[model samples]
Target: MNPLVLPLVLPGVYAPQEDTALLAGALSEEPLPPGADVLDVGTGSGALAIEAARRGTRVTAVDVSWRAVCTARMNAWMAGVPVRIRRGNLFAPVRDRSFDLILTNPPYVPAPTGSRPPRGPARAWDAGGDGRFVLDRICREAPTLLRPGGVLLMVHSALSDPGRTIEHLRGSGLKASVTRRHRIDFGPVLRGRREWLRERGLLSDADEKEELVVVRAELPV
Candidate 1:
């Protein structure tokens, strides 16, 4: 129940990076209304949902992790706000539903093979080869989940073209662009990500370097 619990040790405990948490908190400064309806996709730690709720918004958050789902709802309760947390990949839980604001920090790690992945399937952090697996799927699905004139806020690693993300949203019939950025040591789990790509001859860079991007996409009516 404590915020300091071991996220790595706990099942479905997605310990977000410091920058991720910071980015979530910063959403209040954006143009979102004080009481807009919000959806937090891939609600790791439910930080974004909690933050938006704290800002007086009604939030419905989702994650593939059962523990995360429960944790998110509980975290919202503990924070003295109401949030509907559900278990589903991408937009399954909220099909046919729309939100005024959508936020996601998806699992961008590239799991080239089924045999690989730190936590395996259902953890919601494993994206298939190229890491674009989840990113691409989410982009394609976001428009339908967003309400008319709604905004889709996303945070993903620069390891996979941030520009491509913007392009995807733009091409998907939405207005999109980069809103923020920062870098992090992708941790030991992704240590072999580039190597896996290299083994397949997809990556040629000898040095490891990447950035994470925060993008804002909107479904303008």
Candidate 2:
């Protein structure tokens, strides 16, 4: 797949990493109706949301970081796509709305320390301890926001347990499956946690790669 071109990335905002590309590639293959309502949770540089808008979907993007929100808004404007950008954690800003599709590349890197999510750029990737801090919430809450037949596409490291994601979505009554996977070299955060992760049995000492998986979960019509 050709790389999906992205707009400007503001400092402190998450850029379009491998996980983002994997999810975007899956999004490109989806059969979306014109004007389909789409929501992008934790939208960083607005890459996925803007791409959805390019496909004729009405897209709304939400993020917990003000910088991310601003970056997304600017990117949407630069891309000449009308995307509704809001600032809030996970699904809070869209609690009362329903969407035909949802996209997210949430924080899934296992942090070795406290339960509190760390501040700064690390917030984009550091998930407390088990790395389910954001993923679990998305699985539990996203199904509630989907319209009948709506789909949610999310990407995360295999270290975070893609099976758990599928299970959680299935438990919520959505049919879910892993749609794509890509093995890539460890990024700085993971590199820093390599030993700690190995000690926790989440990673092997010789492992230098992480598998990123894109999950597709859909509501039945």
Candidate 3:
């Protein structure tokens, strides 16, 4: 992988990672309409949102963390892009708005089940034990935020059950599929939870890699 050429990424905001790059690459392949409305859920540091704006789309980015919101705003300004950055969880800020494209790289690291995700830096990852804390919510709520024929491009670790995401999107009447997949060694968070993951039977002691998948879902026009 080449070095990630990114705008200034401030502390406390989620920096772009492998999943972010995969989703961004997938976003580049999308055939967007002129001045399409785009939503970047959980837009930490506004990476995906800025990329969408660079593609000439009108972008809105939202995050629950004040630090993240500030960081994203700074990044957008530095990139000379007009991304509407808001502070909210998931789709709350844009409840009534619909988008032509929705891009996300939500938290998906498996943590202990039933334990609340930690605040601070861990908030960027640290999903519940199954790693679906954020992914499930995104799959459930994101489709409703899509305009007709709109698309959602979400990247998450396959350890979180990518199949379940496809099923949920399909159940919601969107055509969903895995558009991209890549195997990468575990990052810090996952590496720290390596033993726990094995205990949960989600990983094996010999496994050092995890698969990241970009799930694309399109609503019927």
Candidate 4:
């Protein structure tokens, strides 16, 4: 990964990649009211939490990996912000807490024909046997975790089937909307990283290009 790192709302940390810059920018809306509780799901490196905390929102950040939880806490301290980083899968850690804003960057990449991600945190980047597992779960559970009129913001790849996401969210009883989007070339990431796909004969010879969608859904007031 070339020792990739960048200065964020925090300092002195090496992030595994540069994609967080895109995530941070796309999640630019400061959805927290001062004194409001916020939940950051899939707190990879805690960029979203740090940014929200920088604006004075109390944050509870969660991730499946202990390493990710540690990283989020470290980033929060480095940023001179305080965040509660918890270790758990999806929303399991906060089943009892409702928030005014829930921000997530879930693995939405549907598993390609035969490919699967390497076990562990790699799945954080990979969505599923095709990438919608986490997204589907998030949409399905977001309504219950959100306060009335609260919002959920998720960044997902177009490969996750944006249409399906919208439909799923609406079916889950949330009002969904497309808030932002950017096209990302999957060529580099997918080219040399298809072993799992090849193992399952899931990958085609076709080159894959993808769109990244930043969606926001509001729970009814």
Candidate 5:
């Protein structure tokens, strides 16, 4: 299925990129019962939320950046989708809510140690250290937000350790595995941090590409 095209991306908000497209593609193939509840965590431009909404699911999108919240709201409006956009870090805004599906293309770019947590546009992708900063939290928290038989679809770079994500989710009693992977040339962020990544043994000097994987975790009814 073709990835849904976004309507607008405001400055400081993350624009839909390869990771976004990968998650959207996975969402397209997911089984969504009519009126299923869906949550798009760290939703940057409302792309995933709008896509789910188009599929007749009830979508609520959340982001830490107010600019991102505004951008997503506008994009949803432009797409004529009713996505309830909220501003907060991760699932904080939607506490106590459960959903049949959850989608995220969170920040998984490993930043150097001692680097301050990202702000502004950088917050969209600059993850601290091993890049599991946000990913790990999601692994721990997402299961609680999923209804029985619900699924969580998350996209992150292979460098962040998909194995660990799978294990973490499984430890939480959810069945998790990598469902898709796509390799692409390192973007500006990875390219600029190539040396740092190599120092951490997460990347090789000769490697110019990074693999992005979509991890699907399902809750048994």
Candidate 6:
């Protein structure tokens, strides 16, 4: 089931979009044992966390934004699921704790700027140039957060280079690959930056859509 069908999205918090839905769908297909330990990194509105909880998994969610943390907490409360929500950057709030599953839909939109916005709604999508700012960190850190046989289900834009993510995860000793892909029309954010993206060779002149991918990485048991 989709977890964020009607989540309470605070003004500065990110609402569930395509990436969230994509990640949730992948979570639904994962073989989560009852009461499995799960982590939702960057759980903006607790969508994936709620979904995991619905499947009878114990979920702990973390986000960098306080508003997002609060939004997720409230949404999970409304969903009648028990999710431990914390405010911190990726992996910081859950140090030393490993999980059977980790879900993330982090900021992957490549932006003209080199740094993420310090605050505001833009923080949800304004990733640094090349869009590897948060993605690279997750690739490096998430593997360590996974238990033996644990799986990471992450969704990001093709513009961020899913192949690089796979390689990074594999180098970390996890078996990784793209599990799903979806083509979507450029949203307002991408459309407004079309010219800049084209100049950077990240987008083609004829390309009107962006491809989002779900990269699944699993640790060996």
Each prediction's TM-score versus the true structure = 0.84, 0.97, 0.96, 0.82, 0.96, 0.96
How does candidate 2 fare on TM-score?
0.97
What TM-score would you give candidate 1 relative to the actual structure?
A: 0.84
In candidate 5, what are the lDDT values of residues 74-160, reduced to their tens digit? 988988889998899899988889999999999999988545788778888988898988999999999999999999999999999
Error of 4 at 174 (Å): 1.5
Give lDDT for model 4.
0.72
Evaluated at residue 134, the lDDT of candidate 3 is 89
- Lowest lDDT sum, 10 consecutive residues, model 3, at 1-10
Error of 6 at 27 (Å): 0.5
lDDT by residue for model 6 (157-200), tens: 99999999999999999999999998888889999999999999
How high a TM-score does candidate 6 get? Answer: 0.96
lDDT of 4 by residue, 172-204 (tens): 788987777776566555655656555655555
Segments of candidate 1 deviating more than 4 angstroms = 1-9, 114-122, 198-206
Compute the lDDT of residue 122 as modeled in candidate 1: 36
Which 10-residue window in model 5 sums to the lowest lDDT? 1-10
lDDT of each: 0.74, 0.91, 0.88, 0.72, 0.90, 0.90
Cα-lDDT of candidate 3: 0.88
lDDT (Cα, 0-100) at 32 in candidate 6: 83
Per-residue lDDT tens digits for candidate 1, residues 1-221, read 02333223245467656445546744766677777889998886787787788888888898877777777777777778888888887799899788899888887766766545446333555666666777888889988888889998887776667778888899989999887776565566567576786676545666464566788888879
Which residue pairs show backbone clashes in model 1? 158-211
Q: Global CA lDDT of candidate 6, please?
A: 0.90
Tens digit of per-residue lDDT, candidate 3, span 132-221: 898888888998899999999999988999999999999999999998999998888788878888989999878999999999999999
